[model samples]
Target: MLGADFYMPTRVFFGENALQRGKEMLLKAGHHAFIVTGKSSAKKCGALDEVTTLLQEGGIPFTVFDGVTENPPLLTCFEAGAKAAACGADFVIGIGGGSPLDAAKAIAAFAANQGMAPMDIYDDAKRLCPTLPLFAIPTTAGTGSEVNPYSVLTLEGGMKKKTFKAPDSWPRAAFVDPRYAYTLPHGATVSCALDAFAHALESYLSPKSTVFSQTAAVFAAREIWDVLSAMPGEFDVEMRTRLALAATVAGMAISVTGTGFPHPLGYSLTLLDGVPHGRACAAFAADYITYNEKSDEGRALIAAFAAAIGTKPNVMKAFLPGVAEVDFSFTEAEIAERIELVAGAGNYQNSPYVISKEEMYAIYRAHFLKK
Candidate 1:
């Protein structure tokens, strides 16, 4: 009894010269655009230039806000929103990786609802305004922030990350030009790919997963595995394109099923230990698979995933360690504290089986506790 429930409204333009090919769709977002991005990736990747050229050619005015940082803060979104509103921007364009893309969603929300408090973005029940139309141009093959409605932001004065999700937050269009990622550094490329892999793996294993999402997840996971297994070699344009598509597919999968334990469990490592988001999430991937293997259905699912990626389950688990390098150690108390922080995460409920605090502590101990 295969069933599916999928909803993806963003029009995606993927492959070489995607931005140029999709320029007409991009221009339809709004006449006045508020471009949101981090400090450098957009310019380095040439996405900014291409977007500006397109906007200029279309006679659409735009304002660029390049202040977004890694694990973007709530205050940053609020500030950028104020700037966008001040400029009378009618739409928002997000350029760069997940950070800027996520920030753009918040900026759109804030810009649309002037004077809304920073925390108000998280409270959908209290929100009374619609978000500005959003367009995404991804400079990296990670986060797939271009397609999803989730905007993960750091709380003020804290390392904790929270997601702001609304139906209106989805980008109206996504330009996924693989050429934009050609300038990405080697480490970033690997990290981004790993993040996509985690998304697919988690989504496939989620209890909420449907036939549609599982099919997407398996395809994305297979594509990512192919790219990752060929690492330490040249990532030519073809390889980048495959990875980019995989990331986008993974994002679409998670949009339906949401992520499992790895995402929430990885947040502390990313924020506190300075591990890259993708690598941090992947650090727990093997263990997450193992944890689920405790159940019969879970074992079947893992086998299915392994078969889809053309590898044995154990072999796939072994391959993760080479890429997800988490060297830091934590005291038993610290491990317990970290587990406590994420114990209440909604992702746990999405898991195939109940995840007790004790089980979480054990997983943390296996990875982070001092021997």
Candidate 2:
């Protein structure tokens, strides 16, 4: 067990119809609100309508700023902050996927105090002030941006994907309703589910992991691997519910322990190659774990836990999708170069073992290349 501090300040409302409490939660923050959401999916599913309606019924005046992009940009968050100020929003509401939720957090923090750019906030979180109250309603189950204090956004000038972590950024309230994710596109479902798995596994191996965080992360990994990997192409309701639950737990685990290695390296791919965060991270899990096994840390425990949950085979298959008929389309040199590039990312700062740059490069090539 490693020594670490655990801090979880967000109030969460879970399960079906959990979103109906949004009205009460918003009222606690204040009457005037600014809502942030992605432009397309939430509107199409009518999830945005439910949130807006709840605010109206509660006699809360709110304005929805639906400009969030796939990988939230620093410039967009800055603009959104200005909009919130114009609306006189006393509280900021985030009502969509992780992108929108994270955007709301940054925008809310800057709405009252223009001390920092969203990209710069990650580099210098002290610039954020304790201003406009924060609340989150997640339309998707992955990222756990609702409860966690970190927000990942794409920075301008060189396409850097940055991280923002501040105590004041954690939402005062977060509403999780599995019903909202049912309408997510198939690609998004698979990608975000994989992302949750990465969160669970990364946190499980973190040097800062405590007993509680390890248990939450491992169980979340097991549950998600069992549910999402086993679900048929049609995406059954029961399976989706189980996946959603697993995502929430994984999010909670990362909130305390934090993730390592694969996340930073994965962020590079998402930012540069245009791969989705979840998919890019998931692709590296097997290789990264193989590197951990060399240190003889938690290898047997991981394998046993995975098998006990009846998920080893399916998860293995799901993550290494390129092994099958799916074409990876990467040359041997390109793969190796990418591995070396990500090694310089300093992800080792959060890794359980200090991995040398060369060793990190080898790990990527080991799994990516043929046996």
By TM-score, the best candidate is 1
Q: On residues 1-371, what C-alpha lDDT tens digit does candidate 2 reach at each position? A: 45556678888887788877555766767868898888877787667888778777778898889899888887888888888887888899888888998888888877877656555565454564675788887887678788888777777753566667776888888777888888987777877788888888778777778777777787777777776655467667776787787787888888887777777667656666677778777776766666666565656545654674565633564454442122244556766656654565545766546677776656556545554
Off by over 4 Å in 1: none
lDDT of 1 by residue, 135-203 (tens): 998999979888889999999876678899999999998999999999998889999999999999888
Error of 2 at 267 (Å): 1.9
TM per candidate comes to 0.97, 0.88
Clashes of 2: 0
TM-score of candidate 1 against the unseen true structure: 0.97
lDDT of each: 0.88, 0.73
Residue 329 lDDT in candidate 2: 46
